[model samples]
Target chain A: MKYVITLLVGMVTGAVAFVLLLYYNPFVGNQSVSPLAVSELDLVDFSYSLLASDSIVFTNDGESHMQPHPAKVLQLWEPTVKMTRALVTILNDSRGQPAGLGVKFSSDSEKTRLINAEVVVDSVWHIYSPEHGTFFVDQTENFWPYLHDIVVPARLSGGDSWRGSWYGITSTGPGALGIARVTGGAGDFADTEGEAVESIAARAYSAITGPVAMTGKLTIALPRQEALP
Target chain B: MLKIFYLGIVMGIAAAAALVYIYPVVDQHREPSLITVRPNGGNSESFHIRLPGDRIMAGVTGSTELTPLALEWPEHDFLANMQTELFKVRNENDVVIGAASRMSGWSEQHGSFVEWVVHLPARGSMFMTMAAKPSADGYREGKLRAGTREFLTLNGTVIERFVNEADDSDSDNVGRIELVTALVGLPDELE
Candidate 1:
């Protein structure tokens, strides 16, 4: 009886093991499908420059399959798109009149509050309105360049307010793309000293106010006249 | 002795199950465009119409939940534009999953806007793309004499009005704003 019981147990165990192996990885014996080829995905980079000055950058890695119609190699598996926005805003005067705005597209994603901008042309001089507060933008330099600089200019307007809007310039291409936007920092010059830029910049000055939100669009296809061949 | 043999069998089955994996080359979706904006007028910054709820399509690794981003400057049409076109590859249910993304001119890590939480089974895979930001295109808002040369401030950012394919003033038209990804994320495994 003991021998029979031991034989029965052994047979049951062997059966279970066989079933598990067969069902779990039926292809284990074949070895025809290369593990590397099965899961292997190729990575490719892509970029597109819009008719406008804006540009896009991206990366993608997907299946190298053939298109149904064209039969062309379509990386159907991997797809990516990037857009860049040049942040700018328009304000209103007492007559409820509208005025011109400015924008600078700083690529670096680092740096929290500020972005370094190049004046593409000599149009107008800009300043931070105390009432409207300070606008946040990605710094041209590394992240947190002004880790401790929070001194508002001595001459700051108080109680006064201004209005404005933001814009984004995005673009894309075959594989990858890029999008740009002005760094809209969390808040005005974060007083490394404190959150009292109002008091510091105000300095018993006149009235100042905070800036308001505005709108714009992402111009992808630019006219040939406005674009470089 | 019999019990020991049974245990070994059980262990072998478990081990085989653990080794199971499928490299699914999912050509599930195409283009992966979640947003599109049509220009109505020649050059106008007007919120004339909308597409309701202003929803956006997101695709992540496998199937994972996502969160709505609270941008510092929400009011600007930026959110609107992002909503419709914030295209990200996702699972059937629509989750922004990311394990590996191959995008040029950019590098990305999980948990950027939404809380980053995702994992892959042993041989699982994930693929995604990050869209580039605007302004980096080099189109200057005309030019600036001084101050922060970026977004809205006291004076505001401006660029010279150019022309588009229509030869009309190159008004604000988001040519293409998208982000896509797809892959097998772990099945409810620790994120």
Candidate 2:
């Protein structure tokens, strides 16, 4: 009987101790190493090509050569733009995480709009343009969504390719009695749709270190909008 | 005594389990943290922290208050291209610490703004503010400002300051305006 009684007491004591341990939160302590620190090395190289199209409307005034005209004609203007870039590098920071990106372009070529643009990604992504200084790309911003979709996935290896489409509206010129004209009317506008395609292939030399290469193409074609007769 | 031993063993197991869970939480809470920048007019998404062994810890708590320091937008045809706004956070040495960007709308609206709060270890804290302005001539400009009140020990005390400006033309003929500022001092470790 004594033995059973002692056993019961011990069980009760142990249960109470367990409850206390949970309540006091004894597990709270410091970590020997920071989990946030990244220690791996990942090197990536990529190329991008783009072809896009937009629909534009142009106004044609047969009589007015330079001065303003009250009434004018309407015409459609379609402009196509093609851009390509090669040998972009993604570099890691001291923490072994993706910290910066550098893109090299041919300075002599006018087609290279972004020349030597360096982007640093720490708390925020900073795209540094020699002509524009630094620009921030956040999730709330327009540029972030497009670049994020392309750059984030392209950093990894194996089947890294993506395609998408976007649409926008543009207007030009002054108000001419609320007339629907392009470049000279009160409401001259162009509705544009753009498509982009990207393909990236990566080769990992080692478990912690490797090289990744990507090639992308974007084509933008502007279509003409006919006037209503 | 044998029953007591068994009870102790069970209690030890429970204690170990509890410690394992609490250790990480305590460690994370004490470390410098940051939150994910929420999309404009969208729900808040979880912030991710990369862990060892291909593990990731999501939904970590950190600051999301990004403040603008300066802004400059050149006059141009606004309707020709989509308007853009960019925000950057930098230390006193003019080193960029954080940044964010978004599309500016073509409307005469007021009070449209976004902010980010950054904490620098042993240096100080700062908040960046980027406010959208009314579109003029189809060109949209943003106002930038910075403050240290969120983590400032004293109100109105000058801790650090920065300025950022970006002005360039893109292929689309869109005149770009930039803001660059060194808003906070570097941490003691960095210095």
Best by TM-score: 2
- Highest lDDT: give the candidate number: 2
Residue B46 lDDT (model 1)? 10
Query: Residue A183 in candidate 1 has what lDDT?
Result: 20
Candidate 2: count of backbone clashes, pairs at least 3 residues apart or interchain: 48
Error of 1 at B182 (Å): 26
Question: Residues A119-207, candidate 1, lDDT per residue (tens digit)?
Answer: 11111111112222122111222211111111122113243432222122212111122221122111222111111000001112111
Off by over 4 Å in 1: A1-184, A189-229, B1-10, B13-163, B166-191
